[model samples]
Target chain A: MGVVFETVVISFGILYRYNLFKREKERLAFELEINKTQTTLQLIATQEAERKRIAEDLHDALGGNLASIKMNIQNMAPGNTQLSTVVGLLDKASEDVRSISHNLMPPEFSETNLKDLLANYYNQLNNRGSVRFNFHTSGIDRRFNKIDELMIYRIVSELTNNILKHSHATEATIQLIYYEEYLEIMAEDNGVGIAPQISDGIGLKNIQSRVNYLGGKINIHSNSFGTTIIAMVNYKK
Target chain B: MGEKIQLVIADDHKLFIEGLQSILDNHPEVEIADIAENGKELLEIVRKKKPDVVLLDINMPVINGLEALKYLKREFGQIKVIMLSTYNEEHVVEKAKAQGANGYLLKNVNKADLIQTINLVHLGQSCFPYRLPAKQGLPGISDGFLEQSNITKREGEILQLIKTGLTNQQMSEQLHLSIYTVETHRKNIMQKLKLRNPAELMKFIISNNL
Candidate 1:
């Protein structure tokens, strides 16, 4: 009887230890997943910073050099046939460089308030392709914190990029409605609808994360006609 | 075009200044008197050259365009200043106008609009990008605009009267107020609407459908 009791106690101890180990392992796995997501987020932010730095370098260095070259070539005077052609080429190349750098880097946020940034982005989109862009703003003059502004800008830019890449549609509209307490953005594209079985891609996921970071909500409505994304955030938050 | 509009262009970007210089050099009615890299330099050149107009960029080293504009207005009120910029942020434009900038133009504007703006500024009329009707002056004194802009009820009444082509004297008579009070009201309306002069206020009244 004594031997049997001792064996039962040993068995209980083994079972208890196994369960504790299992629980700890599960907790560690969950933490690893969270850490992975956090790293991804940080990596993305760093990548954007890197892109901006590179873009600025390219613009300030290469673009400045190109402009100077063109100026020098033009300064050689109009009668020089060969130089004029080279000057013309340099001018075209400089313009291309400007466009590329602009695409790579964000606008000077300090210089432009939110409304101007949106209008400028819309104008750029309109210029880039056949898409007709209609940007409307109401009571959007008030400024927000820099982080909020940057996040909102990123959301808009990412959404627009998706539209330009995937939506073959010709017409799109972006609206910014500023309420007393909250700011809302609505972007609509008459593109091919999102597939029903399609999972959220990286772009959409990035937008979702940004909106979440801003303590906002985003709703995407898509059909055969097109897609519309509505996002709202409380400025106070 | 009687006397070509003499211009002093101020921009930090050397390439842009040169491009503008080349463009203006070809124009019959526009002459580039001098170019400055920044606002301080602009002031120095303006003091020497006394150009009829100064095309100023908003962002510059060693005193911004707006800062220089204030000084210029205080010292040399006769020289018309046009704010030329790549970005048309409405508030900045409004502030520039409030500082007595005669006009605003985008750098990307075609030669025709640029020339037209220069001429208009020279003629003592305010100018802005044609696409930006509201920035040139208040487009109209619409009820929505009044509410959005926080114009008082009395001010709204005055604005409406002004829109109807009522002179300050006529408004004083109609509203049963002193002419001095009416004049004060008119001045307040211009300040609130960011209109530089009576002509722009009139344009605003017509364009706004008010």
Candidate 2:
């Protein structure tokens, strides 16, 4: 009887030890995951800050100088054909700089809300007439925090750009649904769906990273007729 | 027309300001009353000099051109303001217009157009670029005519207005041009197109699909 009782006690002790080990392993994994997220967030923030600095330098220094050069050239010889050609080149250069800087850091990002920014972007795309884009929203009259808004904007931009470049889609739609606790984003396109092999492409990967940073879940559905992507992310009022 | 038009220029770039000054030196009608390096300096100078027109740069230090424009419009309602910036974005232009800017010109504006815009703005007229729709078929056909007839861009613009059957006075008002200038452009258009009269001009316009 004593031997049997000792066996039972030993088994219980072993079982308790195994459970503690498993719990510790899980805690370690969770800590590693948190560290990874923090590192990635820091990297992204640093990259954004660098981009903003470069954009400002480009706009303020290079753009201003180019404008000054054009003005001086025009003043030197108003109607000289050769100077006019140079001015044209300068204008193109200035435009390129402006576009590059604008893309790096949109000037309206700080001033305008997410909806306006997306609307402006969509309007520009529609005006190009290459791909028709429609945006729909519900319960989004209130603005989200800038960081969340920016992340969502990036996700949508990546999705639409992917569609425009690869999906061969003539029409696309982006819908936003805001709930009390979280927001849902759905991007749909009427085109050949994403190829299975290209599902893990850089664009989608970047979007996945953003969604993960936002602590969101994303699902992609693709078939011959079209592709639809849905992402849900929590937000604070 | 008798008194010289007083002007105050505001831009952060000294080189750009000097270039503008050199260009305006040839035009005796426009007198540079004062120059400001930024929006703050601009307000101070405007208050002291009371210039007739202010060439305000959109991007500036301390206070931006748009804000300065608002203050100017509210405090000194008589002073005319023109937004001179490299940014030709539609929203910026709309904001300037909404804030009572008399004219909006890109930084690459030629000397002739710059002087003319200032003069028009001083004459109580507004001058803004006519943004044609992106998908419009008119631009292509208009470009063909311009290339074939050696017509200047300003003439092309006037031709489009003429196609709409606008009178000389109406064209002047819409384009911020004097009636005499409108008549001159009309004569030049007729000469270039070899049209005898307004009827022939209309016929030419239809035949060319311009």
Index of the highest-DockQ prediction:
2
lDDT of 2 by residue, A178-234 (tens): 655877777867788889889999999999989988889888877776776878888
Docking model 1 quality class? incorrect
* Candidate 1 C-alpha lDDT tens digits along A1-237: 999999999999999999999999999999998898688668767877887788767765676567545544554466789886776687677667766776776546655677877776676566557776666666645657765677788888888887887777787767676766777776777778666654388888989998887778887777666776878888864
Candidate 1's C-alpha runs over 4 A off are A1-108, A123-129, A134-143, A177-184, A195-199, A232-237, B1-7, B13-35, B83-100, B103-128, B132-210
The candidate scoring highest on TM-score is 2
| Model 2 lDDT per residue over B60-85, tens place | 99999999999999999999999998
Candidate 2: misplaced stretches above 4 Å?
Answer: A1-34, A179-181, B98-100, B128-210
The predictions' CA RMSDs to the true structure, in order, are 15.1, 18.3
Give the lDDT of residue B185 in candidate 2: 61
Model 1 lDDT per residue over B120-141, tens place: 8899898964442322122344
